[model samples]
Structures are given as C-alpha cells and as structure tokens.
Target: MIFMYMSHLECPKCGATYDPHKLTQLCACGSPLLVRYDLDKVKANFKKSDLIGA
Candidate 1:
C-alpha cells in the first residue's frame, strides 16, 4: 500500500510539475523537489500539541 496525501510537486531548480502521489527522485536536470502543503487545512485539522518537538 502507498500513502497518497501529497498534493503537488515543485522542482527546486527548474520549478517543474510532477505527480505527488508517485515515487520520485531528484530531477534529471539536477535539482531537488519539494512537497507543498495546504497550511490552512493542516492547521484546521491538527493542533500544535499533536506534533512532537525536535
């Protein structure tokens, strides 16, 4: 089974789009990809106490 909550992917170098639900690696052109979050939704559904401190 795969966890599929991720919404979008943005390239660190060229800012390209990819499927967030799929397994991915650094782009062939040489850059990292970052996962984006819906902050409002996350905040509405979760609280500060729900997370562990570093």
Candidate 2:
C-alpha cells in the first residue's frame, strides 16, 4: 500500500503542483519537481528505524 503521508509533487520555484502517483516531467517554469509529504502524519506512523535498511 502507498504511504498515507505521501501527498503530491510540487515545483519549489513556481509553486506548481502535480499528482504524486503519476509520472510528471518538469514544471512549466522549468524547475525540478519535488515530492511533498504530510510530515506530521508520516511522523505519527513511521519511525526513524524504519529507514535502517533502505
């Protein structure tokens, strides 16, 4: 299952947003996109140790 906190992709420079589950190219403003997450929700569900082997 997908993580509940994984929200969407966003362009940091232009503030453009895109669907996280889909493949997306660069934003129209020509900036690289980044994955956005709900940090509070993620923190509630995951532990730092979960990343040990990843």
Candidate 3:
C-alpha cells in the first residue's frame, strides 16, 4: 500500500477541516473546500519529475 500525504480538506472561509476520506464537496459555510497536505512528509521525496508519467 502507498502512503498518502494529504492531511485533510479545509474550508477557506470558515477555517473548518473535514476528513478527506469521506464524500464531500462544499463546506457547511457554503464555501468551496480546499485540500490540505502534509507537505513535510512529501517535501523531502517529491519533485516535479515525479508527475512526468502520472
């Protein structure tokens, strides 16, 4: 299994966070949700070249 770096989904307007595993679209505040990641986990191993074939 591959480990993912995504932390959670957050609402920009209300600053609310939701689980990324569940089905969701807009936040309760009626604002679009944003994806938040644990960049610290990927920063050391990720690079632009990783997306070349993906």
Cα TM-score per model: 0.56, 0.63, 0.70
Candidate 3, residues 1-54, lDDT tens digits: the string is: 123887899999999999988857799999999888888777745665476647
How high a TM-score does candidate 2 get?
0.63
Residue 2 in candidate 1, Cα distance off native in Å: 14
List clashing residue pairs in candidate 1: none
* Cα lDDT, model 3, residue 50: 71
| Candidate 3 C-alpha RMSD relative to the actual structure | 5.4
**Candidate 1 lDDT, tens digit per residue, 1-54?**
113335677787888877876767676677888886656656644565366431
Off by over 4 Å in 1: 1-5, 47-54
Best by TM-score: 3
lDDT per model vs. reference: 0.66, 0.80, 0.80
Q: In what order do the candidates fall by lDDT, top score first?
A: 3, 2, 1
Cα lDDT tens digits, model 2, 1-54, are 345677889999989999877867688899989888888777755665477646
After superposition, the stretches of candidate 3 with alpha carbons farther than 4 Å from their true spots are 1-3, 47-54
Model 3: lDDT of residue 48: 53
Candidate 2's C-alpha runs over 4 A off are 1-4, 47-54
